[model samples]
Target: MSIAGQIAASCQRAIGITLARMMSRRQFGQTLFEHQALRLRMADLQARVDLLRYALHGIAEQGRLELRTAAAVKVTAARLGEEVISECMHIFGGAGYLVDETTLGKWWRDMKLARVGGGTDEVLWELVAAGMTPDHDGYAAVVGASKA
Candidate 1:
């Protein structure tokens, strides 16, 4: 999860840099970053990045976390990374899709891999659910006994 958060932060910084470059060119009589819509989107993305950072910090401060909490963090971080990269790509226009044109393409690929590289978002969700269940121990015991 920390890794995912770090990746997201890096992607956000890259997007900021790209937006700054675009703003300098004065596309269509105004910079894309100067538009209210883009500004709002960027704000939202920043909030998400901050939220992920906060979550990570809180977990670290606690010195320990349950499986469900860890899973939740992982899921949130992975999703945030995906969202950040996608938005960055949108800001980059068609050039975002070309690896030779922009690093956003590589970031996008890395985010996709992050989503599936671990236990996967779906598997993590299931782990969270199983851990949250009140009968988790009993259920595990039943399954274990059956395996014997």
Candidate 2:
């Protein structure tokens, strides 16, 4: 596979593992809020998110985050994969085009399938730009949501 594919695949694996860890039922009570000593953790997490939202304040951050999110991950994976595979294909360009596994053709094929799996990079960039500004009344919404 090409460098793009290799990078994307590695990132996918790492992200998958992290999400898996978060979703595991056994890890439920391990949540930071579950402990009295770390009762402040919830606030800390919120602060962190708020900071992240701010840090990613412009189009650049938004675009990058959008690309990495669940919505666009597959697409990114495929694109990067294709880039890498294409280069690899170039190394053995003529022969690689016809084969499957060893030729690293699967990388580009998978990426092609994934590119349209969900939102396109352009759409995500727009979405994120739209999402940049925080809701001024968000704290109230959080309070109301918590009560329910």
Candidate 3:
């Protein structure tokens, strides 16, 4: 599996763990999931995960992964993995910091390595930027244009 695929799977797992914990526990006479703010953040995380999957599918269909495109996906996946897992840690509260049987702690430690793996974020960002055209249509070229 690609790095993005692994990150997506980890994000999905963290979300599941967080949701289960939230629903099973209550704060102020209501489940944590009942809170509006928490739900909104969860929705945003889900949206990001879905978009990452869409990008992966698109790349797979192309049957080619340009260096710039691969860098972009790697950077995105690593950042998203960090963000999603960190948010879950916050939602998990002090329990997240504990050394326990849960995979959250393991994922947390592993995700920090992702930023430096498969090339650092700075180098990848430079690669992505270098591929951008200077024309007015550069935005479209960098993003919406077909890889072919």
Candidate 4:
């Protein structure tokens, strides 16, 4: 999850830089940032990043870190990092592919590591599902009570 968070943070920085560059260069009588469609897309990506950050914070606040919580965050953060980085790359167009000009390509390459490292997304989801099962020792009471 920590590695995933780092990926997210890096992607955020790349997205910010790309957006700033687009805003500085006018296109079609207005900067790309001024386009309603582009603005909405950026807003959605920002919200996803913020959601992942807040979820991680919530998990930390529990004091006792549970495997389920860790798995959930890992899945979310890795997915969000991949999404945000991809969007940033689209915004950058051909320039994002150039390693010398921006770290977007590097970030894109590293994002996959987050998904595969520690535990794969499928493995993490299975962990989460196991935690929710009534037969699972830790969640037995909660799951049982919900059924009644």
lDDT of 2 by residue, 1-148 (tens): 1323344543344333323333342333574234444334323433433433343344334564443343333334445545544544543335546654343455457556555555565775565566566676998899899999
Query: Per-residue CA lDDT of candidate 3, range 1-148, in tens?
Result: 2778889989998999999998988999999999999989998998999899899989899998888899999998999999999999889888886758567888988888988888899999999998976776876787766765
The runs of at least 3 residues in candidate 1 whose Cα sits more than 4 Å from the true structure, single-residue gaps closed, are 133-148
Candidate 3: TM-score? 0.88
Clashing pairs in 4: none
Error of 4 at 69 (Å): 1.1
- How far is 50's C-alpha from truth in model 1 (Å)? 0.5
Cα RMSD, each candidate: 8.2, 17.0, 6.2, 4.7
**Model 4 agreement with the true structure over 33-83: per-residue lDDT tens digits:** 898898899989888877777766776677677788788888878888888
Superposed by TM-score, candidate 1 places the C-alpha of residue 70 at a distance from the truth, in angstroms, of: 1.3
TM per candidate: 0.80, 0.37, 0.88, 0.84
TM-score of 1: 0.80
User: Which of the predicted structures, 1 or 3, would earn the higher lDDT when compared with the native?
Assistant: 3
Candidate 2 segments exceeding 4 Å error: 1-7, 10-75, 100-103, 133-148
Clashes of each: 0, 7, 0, 0
Candidate 1: tens digits of C-alpha lDDT, residues 45-123: 8888887778788888899988888788887788888888888788768888899988888888888887877769999
Best by lDDT: 3
